[model samples]
Target: MRVGSRRAPSAPFPGLLSSAQFAALAAEYRRACGFEICACDSDGKLRRGGAERPSEGRSVSDLRKHAVSEALRWGEPSVLSDGIEGVLWAIPVCQNQKLLGGLVVTVTRLRRPSKAGALDQRVVSACRVLLELGTRYNLVNAPLLSERRETARREQEKAEALHLMKEGTFDTIRSIYLREEPALIAAIRRGERSAARHAINRVLTAIYMLGQSRIELLKSLALELVVTMTRTAVQAGGNPENILGLNYQSLSRLADISDQEDLAGWLCRMLESLIDAIESNSRLPGSSQLARAVKYVEEHLAEALPREEVARAAGLSPSHFSHLMKARMGCTFTQLLTRMRLERARSLLVHTDAELAHVAAACGFTDQSYFTRVFRKTHRLTPSEFRRAKRPIRNASAPKSQTSARLYKPGAAVRC
Candidate 1:
């Protein structure tokens, strides 16, 4: 996450994907979908001698640039067209929302069939998913790359002295430590207290082996792990300034820790503190809290639930939870609850033979008339009409056009 002021590399991101890998992916696209992939910079300038180059016509060039710009702006794949030429797909190569560049592909002569357009979209979407996978791979593996570069020289010297001491001991321990590092950071990000603690123990066991009989070495290793944990904690919604200040205090205490057992306990305690910090920040509007609130509401939809009761389930005050619902969910608690109830009602109407009154009560509606009113207002169809339209037809010859009427309103801002 640290930004350096050194001269930037020629590629959009060094070590993220090599040119060979990029070309291979492009080739795969060509072989599979007859689409040519081109590499473009953040400015939408096609990379020279990288992948397949698109036509340098002004319109094609402008379309590609605009596609890249849109993808970067949204931090996702986007499609663009100049109307004359066929569709252009831009899959941005971004990390942490920082736009580096992107891959541009074009099907200049798309078929008039809707299936062709859908197939192209599907292929491009798959490519975007793969690139995102690569981005995450870099995020998880970058630290290992840097560690290897830093230890290569030390490892060479250790090899020269191997005959005079234990062989493969340091390598085995170091490998185990590196293997636990990704798991530890992942668990920390997810706020899994037990899993993080266990991974830290495994990492400490490896560090202890490497620093056997050397307390200073063990302390330094522990400090290194602390630094990694703090970075991860910050990424997991912990306050940066608070975490940094806490880390400073933890480092100051590390100097007095000379016993291996004491150091292990201290690190475990430190991990717990990081977990607490993450949980403390749960009051802030976030997907985890929103999902938890929605899940609680859904699980208790039949009950006469109040906002205060739901807020307690989400571990937030009613007022704060109201604010969170507005900020992250773009709806009030009542609106979300009503929407969820209607959704459940729709399901029960189509999937079960429940009476309208029973369905209304089961979905927390006070009465059947009220449920029908709200459902018709939101969906533009009465609950009975919706059931008739959506109910599976037993006749195999049923015309598809019979079910063409839209049953649910897609324009609603909130569904949960």
Candidate 2:
């Protein structure tokens, strides 16, 4: 198939994908996957490739609009459902951190293939291929897609960091990062990519929160992270020559970035590349699976986590995961989980003035009584007693009684 022209009249920017090329790609997807694909411009206008195929109880236009909106907002491939029985996938086409257009794939319930898992994988693969093709065809610089995706990821993380900032003071956030940095480097050396990614979020959020949104400061801190990660990667058996070359290039790029969000994105991407280096040197079998399981536990510590749920997250059967956990960590899954939750509860007790009940709930304990019993068993002090012993002195002008009220729980006596 041949593209007629580089730009479309209705496109918001130059180098818009031509209608013939768009339709050709859509037609290819339809032929292979039995789904209809359409291209929509930045303004949510259906420039080319969309067919007027209606579903039961929903119009095609409504589904297309939802796909377009979701793609633009998230800048990702999102799978959504029409209220009826159809599935819609929105794959955003971006160039240099700009959302130029997107591809929408629609498949009705009745038309879905019997092998649903295979179908889903094919859909994801097709979205990736289409995105690469579309971006490469339109962009003069193919590497800009990474920047575009990073920009979107940075926006998401920025929103999350802002939300977290509202809940903690600058010191609280700064301390969290200080504690997490060692764990981040440790995870990298162990080639636990998933855990490193989780730690990266905590570290990145703290940087964004404490940097006060200063671009130059953010760049400097980002460079510092690069140095730390590169050093850790070398310790993990990554080639020093190759790693340092990448490090120098990252520093050059960091020097050029003027936007805080872009810097955040670049740091994340660079860290992941360092992680890739570390992972390449990993010697353990199923290390990725173990890393995933550890990451899943870390993320769901506040929830009612089960062995089966965690195993599924790690893509292993429960029995296999249990055996793996025992072989690798020298402990049962439940034992590890209990230790992690208790550790988190201990940190919360020292860092924040959250009540015992609130802390218990946040750490996934059944109740304050159970939490206190476990706390006393582990540390020989009740939760309130531990807090009073370990909590730092407050400098606020509020009266002691008023400050104490925040930790007061009605109907509960403080037991030492």
Best by TM-score: 2
- Residue 171's C-alpha lDDT in candidate 1? 51
Model 2 segments beyond 4 Å from truth?
Answer: 1-24, 39-58, 91-102, 110-122, 136-145, 161-175, 178-183, 190-201, 207-416
Clashes of each: 0, 0
Q: What's model 1's overall lDDT?
A: 0.66
Candidate 1: clashing residue pairs, number: 0
lDDT of 1 by residue, 1-416 (tens): 66776753355346676666666666666544456777666777676333333454545656667886765444455666547646676766655546566677754554455554355444454445544544554522333333444455345434443432345544543455566667666666556675677677656656766788899988888787787778778877887777877888888888899798899889988998887787677535566666777778877888777886787676555666788889887889999999889877886777668899999989987567768888998999999999898786423433434322233233323454
Clash-forming residue pairs, model 1: none
| lDDT digits (tens) for residues 102-210 of candidate 2 | 6777554633565754454455555565555555566323455455566777677667656666767445434555566776766666555656776777667777667
Model 1 residue 107 CA deviation (Å) reads: 61
* RMSD (Å) per prediction: 20.7, 20.6
All models: lDDT? 0.66, 0.67
